[model samples]
Target: MSTEKIKDARRMVHWPGHMETDYIYTLGIAGEKFFTEMKNSGRIFAAKCKRCGFIYLPPRIYCERCFEKLTEWINVGTKGEVFTYTVAYVDVDSSKLKEPTIYAYIKFDGAHGGLIHKLGEVKHEDVQIGMPVEAVFKPLAERKANINDIKYFKPV
Candidate 1:
């Protein structure tokens, strides 16, 4: 190969864009009882707007619609349908994930909006709108206050 061509190849091999940053972080609040239940009871709870009858999954302390403090807690069903989804080639931190992952908004029955989670046990090509799925929880001991406690949704 010519020396000029060798340098061009080396430049492509050492592309700057290939190097990624690792300082990213996520911060959020988990209400006291809301998180405690997930870690200790393995329950999926949502805050309900007592006045407006709106429910917030992944639980919120207040209602967004009416801007009222949520006063009721509802146990959401495990079964839900895919509202929409996208096949992600990257992980949460924007690093390329090894396996292609399906991220979806699942609308649980009787809920107003869907919660986001991974769709598993289904091929990337098989994921479609309105597909039925059920939440698969992590082991009780493995439960955390985070949304990951549900692990992922699988075809039911």
Candidate 2:
């Protein structure tokens, strides 16, 4: 094991461009199930803690409150309301966007936690707190068992 420390600023090697690495990431048990169900059936799910009866929208493997292993899945449906939202004028790279994007934190009908996704088919000025919305899933063949399966939430 080497314990050498680079104290000189000039001694530190700098890599050009970007550090690129290849890796595989999985969403784990709960997330995979949730997305799979939605991608295949167009139905969203929530995990219910039988001990405390607290439902999680993203479906956790364990309950946050009681630490119970959450295996009971409930159909939370696609209906929800915008808890809050923001209009972004720039992309992830901070470049000016062609059109502003509306992102909203949508809370499902009876779930404790919800998802943060882009809202479509509505103008940013029209998006309001407590505005009803629903998931708009992509065509079955085009889905990849991920959050993108639901293209975006659209105002109901």
Candidate 3:
């Protein structure tokens, strides 16, 4: 009998609340030159609105303030302070994390707004607004054109 025929000969049962995702995708630009530069150089980069002086982290291709295409990239310092934070008991998949994860909005030195990232090396309860922190990046080989390339923020 064929493999399909063999499986058809057996009975199977489905369980309630047991399902699988039909599709999942890992989508992003294959070649993000700016992000690559930042990761390899260990410097944070942002897009600046030449018209309005508004800066955007994760470097936007266009300026939200002036509605103009951004042509210039600026380097932001690694040193930052926590603007706000929250402690999450759940992991990315919504399952309980081994330990609570501290997430924070980190305002880089001299930047207007902040970037969100995981906060590490400190207890979740101890994370607070105005806490000084800095970016910690992964090895070059492990980097992707994504925010997660900067692994997490650690105490400065």
Candidate 2 lDDT by residue in tens digits, 9-117? 5675765566789998898999899888988899899999999999998899999888999989999889899999999999889999999989899999888879999
Q: What lDDT score belongs to each candidate, Candidate 1 first?
A: 0.80, 0.91, 0.79
**Candidate with the greatest lDDT versus the true structure:** 2
**Cand. 3 Cα-lDDT:** 0.79
Q: Which candidate has the top score in TM-score?
A: 2
lDDT of 1 by residue, 12-76 (tens): 54645576668834333536676677768876677788889988876777777888987678888
Clashes of 1: 0
State candidate 2's TM-score: 0.87
Ranking by lDDT: 2, 1, 3
- Which residue ranges in model 1 land beyond 4 Å of their true spot? 1-30, 91-96
List runs of model 3 lying over 4 Å from the truth. 1-31, 92-95
lDDT of 1 at 42: 71
In every candidate, how many clashes are there? 0, 0, 0
